[model samples]
Target: MNIEKARFNMIEQQIRPWNVLNQEVLDMLIVVKREDYFPAEQKSLAFFDTELPLPDGSKAMTPKLEARILEELALKKQETVLLIGAGNGYLAALLAYRARHVTVLESSSDLRDLAIGNLANNHVSNVDVVLADAFSFKHTGTYDAIVIAGGLEQVPEQLQKQLNTGGRLLAFVGQLPTLTAQLQTRTSGTDVSTRNLFETVVAPAVGAAPVSHFSL
Candidate 1:
């Protein structure tokens, strides 16, 4: 396969159609080599429109989904971001390119190690990878933005509390086949608002707060 041609096709056919129209984002996609983040055995599928498998029962979100989240976050050059789920560090590397600083939280040891190596290999220096369960992590200063790379049965209340007054967060909510990817913003006075970006399904974040045992 022609690597550049396939990448261009991925940007034009898969990502652009999903409303990733920002020239800056499109440019970053071109600069960041996705294949470098994939396992050698799966490098050929790096640009495919599906989640690439990872060891230890985890999966990377699809390329379009990664682009969509990046676009929706609308990261500013000086803004700091907190990313949940740093699988392979691909999205974190992408985020590092757009944001001033990124702190990524990953749960699995193997994935965390992979993330560090991949980010270094790409010469992405603005990201810090932490091995910890995202659902339980908290931030006192609040970040300019937060991104959950995987879906959750329901948004973690603690996670919501970590947002800065003007921060924005994007995550996939609900179950497979009908999940809605939502972007939420918190105002200066603490008013929160959300907009449904589009529907997409991703593997649920492991250890996300389980739903109530009995619902009304």
Candidate 2:
């Protein structure tokens, strides 16, 4: 398959119709070159509307879903973003093109190395890939936005606390067959507003903060 043609189809056929109509995003998608991030063997599936496998039993989120999350975040030129699962640094590279900077936290050491290498190969300088467990990583400070690249069983309080006041988080919540892509934003004071973008399922996020038991 021709890479350019596949990319055009991905942007026009799958993403744009899903309300990812931002010109900047569409242009960025074209510029970033998703095919470069995939393994050389799997490069052909880079623009296909399917999840591509990673080294450590993980998978990259489908192109359409990634684009939808990008649209929902509504990234600004100077805003900082926190990416929970850095897979192959594909999404971070995309966010880096729009946001001022991106800090990616990944649990697997091998993935962390792959992400760093991929970002460097793509000349994506605005991203910092960290090897850490997402569930317990301390919120060194808040960010303008947070993106979870994988689905979660539940949103953890620590991750929620990392959001700067007025910051937004895009995540896939719940399990397969009933999962929802949710956009959560922190408003003034202590209010949080959530909107469901659509229904989808991707790989599950590992190392999320554990839920407390309430035994009576």
Candidate 3:
């Protein structure tokens, strides 16, 4: 397969139509070599417009969705980022290019090792991969941006508190069959503003707080 051609086709066909127009983001999508992060058996599906499964049942977000999140965050070279659900470290690799530093939290040991190895092999020095439950991990410092790389019924307020004032968070919120990809921005120490960016369904973050159901 012609990898470069496949990459271009993915950007032009799948991502661009989804409104990912940022030149830098488009360029990074080309440079990131996403195939490097996929499991060897799944490399052929690296650019496909669907979620790719990872070890331990986690998933890499679709290319267009990843691009959309990156564009929405508008990361700065001076900003620090926190990435939840660092499945295979693909998104963390992407975030590393834009932010000054990134801290990735993963629950599975196998995935944590996979992410660490992939990032190191790619020479991504700015990201720190930690094996910890996203819901229970305590952060020592706040971040300029936080991206939860999966769907959630609701983002816990405790997790939201990890953002610095003026920081932004991207997550897919809601249940299966319907979900909204929303960006929550910390307007102040105590205030947050949310804007729905698009609609998509993704696997839930491992160990995410489950939604309550009331049956009649």
Please count the clashing residue pairs in each candidate, in the order shown. 0, 0, 0
Order of quality (lDDT): 3, 1, 2
lDDT of 3 by residue, 1-216 (tens): 888888999999999999999999999997888999986888889989988777777677889988898999999999999999878888999999999999999889999999999999889999999989988877677999999887788888987898999999998888676679889999998999999988877777788876323223
**Candidate number with the higher TM-score (1 or 2):** 1
lDDT comparison, 2 vs 3, better candidate:
3
Give the lDDT of residue 94 in candidate 3.
Answer: 92
lDDT of 2 at 210: 26
Question: Which pairs of residues clash in candidate 2, taking residues 3 or more apart in a chain or in different chains?
Answer: none
How would you encode candidate 2's per-residue C-alpha lDDT over 65-140 as one tens digit per residue? 8788788899999899999998888889989998999999999998999999999998989999989987777757
Model 1 scores what on Cα lDDT? 0.85
Could you report the Cα RMSD, in angstroms, for every candidate shown? 2.1, 3.1, 1.7
Candidate order by TM-score, decreasing, is 3, 1, 2
- How much is 181 displaced in model 3, in angstroms? 0.9
- Clashing pairs for model 1 are none
TM-score of each: 0.93, 0.92, 0.94
lDDT of each: 0.85, 0.84, 0.88
Candidate 3 residue spans exceeding 4 A from truth:
211-216
Candidate 1 C-alpha lDDT tens digits along 13-64:
9999999999999999999999999878888899899887887788888999
The pairs that clash in candidate 3 are: none
**Candidate 1 vs candidate 3: which has greater lDDT?**
3
